[model samples]
Target chain A: MTSSLVLGLELAYWQQSILRSLGILLAVLLPAGTFVYLFLFKMVSFMQSRLGPMEAGPFGSMQLLAEVGKWIQKEDIIPEKADRLLFKIAPYLVVSTVLLTYIVVPFGPDMIFANHDTGIFFALAVSSISTLGVLAAGWASANKFSLMGGLRAAGQLIAYELPLILAVVGVVIQAGTMNMSGIVAAQANGEIFGFDGIGSPYFITQFLGFVIFMIAVQAELAQTPFDMPIAESELVTGYLTEYSGIRFLLFFIGEFAAVGAFGAIAATLFMGGWAVPAAWADLNNNIFNLLGPLILMAKMTLVGGFIFFIRFTMPRFREDQLQKLAWTVLIPLSLVNILATTILKVAF
Target chain B: MSEFLRDYLTVAIFAAVAIGLLLVVLALGKLIRPVRPQADKYLTYESGVDAVGTAWDQTPVRYYVFALLFVLFDVEAVFIFPWAIQLETYGWFGAIEMSVFIVILALGLLYAWRKKVLQWL
Candidate 1:
């Protein structure tokens, strides 16, 4: 049952746990830092015809470090009227949920933090815990803008949560397993209408579900076009208005880390996770344990880049329009996608 | 301990690690960061204007309604997950049965929509 090993060495469970802990840290922070530097800074700047930070380290690569340095020395602030304890504890809740999400994601055949049976379900369930932290921050801040932003975030998240959950149902039906590793195995073994050249990535068949999932993810992250909660023009950065210094840094990291986490999930679900095409490599080969994380990271970059590209390009959706899109459009479409997938599953 | 429990232990350990890491960073911040406090600085930010009314005022009831709708669908989604995994074994019977279940819920959503419960106002 000891599924993880480095090189040829067999390690004890405590050793494995330590390794896994470090892996989880690397998995979460690397992508968070990558997305911040690549998409948030460099890509957006290039799109806007301006060079982003080039002074930090080779094209502002060290900008994240600089930002961290700057944020750490600043004062941590809590308003006089705020519920001091909840306001202080809120960022922990948000960032921890983001960290918890990485637990279920399979970085390699053996390189998962925790191999839960209900992997995707567990990830989805824990991810929503951030909403509670958000509400707590808003309520405790006792600021009008914070309250409105928090409530709007709650509404937006809940509305999109359905589509997000339902969209995965189509993939679940196709793979016939809720386990993250199992789903990756299915894709690696799957053939598109008897053609096994490219192992069937769910995105080809679950394209509708994929689209819905991405849209819901955008809304969940409160990215543009669905960023009413954090809409600066309106709510003044929403629930985040009251936070400062290290607490604000925690939320910022959580946001990008979440982007990384969701990007990893999407890559696993729609792309063939860490495995190359079955025709190319035997998935059971131990080589995957080494190459898998790198492959997954590349896929995550692709997915994260797309998400940020859309965030920068789209105009913010009106509040009513946002709710209407989730309820009327995304939900129904995802439900229909489930029905179609189920029918096809049975028919075949 | 059972392997199943071990799996969860890893999760708990990771959670602790995450919190520990955050605390370490926060402690580091506390050591280096200056805490120059001013009375005005502690006041709630209101875009350079003096505060008006308290923010604890009543919010729109629409958010509550949406929460109710979310609960209904969220429960439905939970039920769907197990069915989705077991669909192949259940075959057409499961497909048809779940279709009926989904349609019924869809009808509920439609009812809410028609009644304008989903409106943001």
Candidate 2:
């Protein structure tokens, strides 16, 4: 049974894939947005022993929905002196790059939109384009605070991008394919710790890569210790200072979507994607393709929860210290991990 | 269309959809949201002080140096990716080649470090 095209255009084989891709994009955004809002606010608030946004929905669950309404109705402010064109386009550029990342995300077994051979590579490269949007937003704002924010973003993302890609290389080496599904398949092949009955995830063998990736992702998301770019206390909401209302809302959505996207990538890379645990090893049967996305979402929640937990708990790093952590620390560590991984791959 | 073309087409379509969504939201918000402009609000915010000359001041050159350094290492890191995916087939031969490449890059980083080029002013 195939989905009917509403546009009245005759469908071809490849068009079906595009249709399915658009369907997944439409379906995933609501849940992804909800998951980001609730998980971040609740987890951060719970850490601080405070109730967050409880008045809006049950335990403030409906708060983000209400926020969307309020933001849509609020005034859209473009500063008078700002570069009007870049100011307007920057947020869309960011949100679009992030939204595009969902295209390659493997939702389930054979459940991906586009199963490119360069899947992981494609996702990383496209997401980096959001940094340009960030710089544009900063430069066009005509605010010194925004300029600093943009520069910090450029410096931080550029420094962390190396380690992030390098860390993934360890997993890519082990998995033998850049395809997201192939990485999951590699993880599902056998048990880790031999007797533990859990699938041997790359997280176990590539522990250093996992650590570096997590740190780099934290920086990539610009949260907490790595959130120097948009630190409210210092930069007055940083690059976002001049933005208000709907344009600001675009950046907000883009940031959360990026967190969700990166979390999905990390889940796919190190946590065995959609692989059901050993107890459900038999359930890994290809027929239960629907279970893949559910399993993947569960893993994402755990990883994302941990990331938000650390975000809430950690203090902001000094600017130089943040760069130092990426270069002097994560880069060298990821390199060592790659060397070790190569040796193991050769010997075994 | 060929599958390769379709794959990239999906990316283009996704981008179009996102931009379209942003435009829709902004247009909708413009219909609903209140627009109140005042002369005071238009001035650049300098801790609420009156009338700053201009915000487009010269930023320190330190950020430029880091960007240059980033380009150097980031380009070097890109080579590791293709080598990584093919590591098993080429075995020790590929491994040794990668090590020399990495060692050279490491020396560059070390050289920059000793030169204090990496140090934040």
Candidate 3:
């Protein structure tokens, strides 16, 4: 069935797979986005040593619900001077751009949608377009802060985008494939110091590269130590200063969605998304293939927790510092990482 | 998809569904919620004061310079991509191409640094 379908481009299977992938993606996205938002919302309040939404529904989890309810019913305000078309279009654009990146992410064993040969690149390219949505949102608001924020986003995204790609290149070199599952598979089959496959993890194989990747990802997500564009005190919530109510909700969803997307991607590439750790190789027999996939999710959730931990702990960087890191440190490091990767390919 | 085609299809389908679902949720929210737009509420105001002054705000030229320098480097950085991609097969040739590319990239950085642009930020 698989071979013959392949020969004929089986439209039914293609259609079915597409539908199934969509269902799976929605399934992952809803839960992932909700998880990140709820986790952060709680963490933020918890750090202040105050009780968060602990009454709404069994633990104040329904706080997001009440808040979302209030936002939805709130008056939709449009500034008379605002560019109306762009104003209406901006939020949806930003929101769409942010969540559209989940197509290539592998959630469990062979569970990715549209597993492109260029899965890594596909994710990168799609996510890159989100900056445009951000930029548009800023420009359309017809406010100076919004414009500045938009410009900042454009600069920041364009600036750090290279280092991000370069670090991913190192992973590609080590894994010997660009497809994400392939990267995870490489981790699964990686040499463990020749003791019948007992080599160190990819992090050990390419320590510098891993650091570069992590920092670049931090920059890409505009997280702590790189979050200049949205520095609330400086630009007044950056591009979102003028947005209110449901529109504000859209922007909010977009931001948290990115956290989930990046978390999933990082898990797939570096932390071995759904792939099991080395000690569990004996469990790779036919009967345990199912368990192998669960191991991958466990790893993903672990990484997601760490990301939330960092968010709660770190402080934002100044715009100058953000640019400096991108241009001076990240760009140079990216170039050198590429150089090392090429040398490793040739010499090793 | 023989193992190969399934992979590509997976991505395409997933992308469509995530985006579709997000829109659905958002649109559903709008449909269910009652929107009330008041004439006075829509008035342009800063800090709750009305008709204080024109909305055109001032910004430093330095940020523009930062963006300009950023664009130049970003475009140049893309050059390394093709070479890095073929590194496994091109080996020494790819390495040499990359070195030359890096040299030019380094010079661009040098130009930015000498002009004290990075210092400005």
Off by over 4 Å in 3: A1-18, A192-200, A277-279, A282-293, B1-19, B51-79
- Most TM-score-accurate candidate: 1
Docking class of 1: high
Better of 1 and 2 by TM-score: 1
* Residue A316, candidate 2: alpha-carbon lDDT: 94
Q: What value does the lDDT take at residue A209 in candidate 2?
A: 92
Pick the winner on TM-score between candidates 2 and 3.
2
Off by over 4 Å in 1: A1-15
Rank order (by lDDT, best first): 1, 2, 3
Q: Chain A TM-scores, all candidates? A: 0.96, 0.92, 0.87
Q: Clashes in model 1: which pairs?
A: none
lDDT (tens digit, per residue) of candidate 2 on A253-346? 8988888788889999998887755455664468557888888878887887788888888899999998778778888788788888888888
User: Candidate 3's residue-wise lDDT over B15-119, tens digit each?
Assistant: 565556666766776777766767876665445556544445665546576667666765664655445555778768767877787778778887887888787
Give lDDT for model 1. Answer: 0.91
* DockQ, model 1, C-alpha based: 0.81
Which of 1 and 3 is the better model by lDDT? 1
Instruction: Give the top-scoring candidate (DockQ).
Output: 1
